[model samples]
Target: MTDPLVSLPAFREAAAERLGAFAHTTVPDSPGSRRAGVVLCVVEHEGVPSVILIKRAYRGRNAGQWGLPGGRMDEGETPEEAALRELREELGLAVGPAEVLGRLDDFPAASGFSITPVVAAPSDPGPLRPSPDEVHSVHHVSLARLAADDTPRWVPQIDGGHLLQMRLRPDWVVHAPTGAMLWQFREVVLLGREARVADFLQPDWTRN
Candidate 1:
């Protein structure tokens, strides 16, 4: 059967309910470091749902990885504020406070930032211009594509294994740099399921 219509509020509520179960207690305390925020913008087109993803420029840290629109949270700026700021800075889109549905559990990066994914809806559909300073391109992939049974696989990285090793599709794969909030957004909010980071397998770029 086709999935029921998933509204922003419904998704947010589901995320909030699931947050308590997945919430992290102790964040890493490092010198000169601070909390960060991210925005997961979900937009609907012609009754079909999709999400906005950004391809970071292959120059700086985590270059060429697929991720959402987000960056570091400035002092005194709330997660919601940081999300809006990042969206405007990266995509030149103005998303207001009301558009935010709610927040999901903060995903800690191995690189050190405690990233929070803020879920929001756009006021209207319009042209999106990618800022060359940060983004390489912006594209919308259908939720249906991600939810499909066809799993993504890659070759396992080894010193001298067979040239072709089958790697299982990760439950989530938010590319580096962009810090794309992939897995949790898909399983928890969209699919209403829970997944572990270990469930995902990173691709071997050398094989590609």
Candidate 2:
């Protein structure tokens, strides 16, 4: 049997409902702990629900890394506010606070900042104008691709140990803490499952 078609409004409604029900965890701000907000922007592309990703312009440690469009929160700014501002700055998508579905746990990054993932949708997610100053490229990955098997994997790190990663088109490995944020969005927002992101060293899911 063929599955029924899901309209854009219906999809967004479902997402909002699921995300709102989840209790998001917060990481308290400590000395030397900065606050950064990364958006999990969802859109319907060719009838599929997709998420936006960005490749950082070659700039020190974050160069060439695929991540959500965002940056450090400005003084007195909320996480959702920062995420929406980033959507406009990075991708030219004028997303608003109303489109912000919900949020995930605060992820502690090796870079010494706590990242807050704000799940949202743009009013007009269209032809993106990426900022060369910050974005090297843009990708719209389908949510289905994220929830698929063999996507979130434990990859061998160069120095030692391993890090969690999410594989995209043609085997592009997005390493954590970006990978960790994506996984949380997939499980908590898309799949409507309980999830939490701690350190990037381990998967946050407890199902065995």
Candidate whose TM-score is highest: 2
**Cα lDDT of model 1 overall?**
0.61
Q: Candidate 2, which segments miss by more than 4 Å at Cα?
A: 1-7, 156-162, 202-208
In angstroms, give how far residue 116 of model 1 lies from its true place. Answer: 1.0
Clashing pairs in 2: none
lDDT by residue (tens digit), candidate 1, 75-157? 78988899889888888888888777666666556555677787777757356878887998777655665555552223344
Residue 91 displacement (Å), model 2:
1.3
Task: Candidate 1: give the clashing pairs.
Answer: 67-180, 68-180, 170-200
Q: Write the per-residue lDDT of candidate 2 for residues 1-208, one digit (tens) a residue.
A: 2211134565577778887788888899888778989998888777877888888887744777778999889999998888788878988888878778888898888777788998887667667889888989888788778888778878786668677778876658876788888988878766778877685674332110
Q: Candidate 1: where are CA atoms >4 Å away?
A: 1-30, 45-47, 151-180, 196-208
lDDT values of the candidates?
Answer: 0.61, 0.78
Lowest summed lDDT over 10 consecutive residues: which window, candidate 1?
A: 160-169
lDDT of model 1 at position 121: 70
Residue 207 local lDDT, model 1: 16
Question: For candidate 2, what is the lDDT?
Answer: 0.78
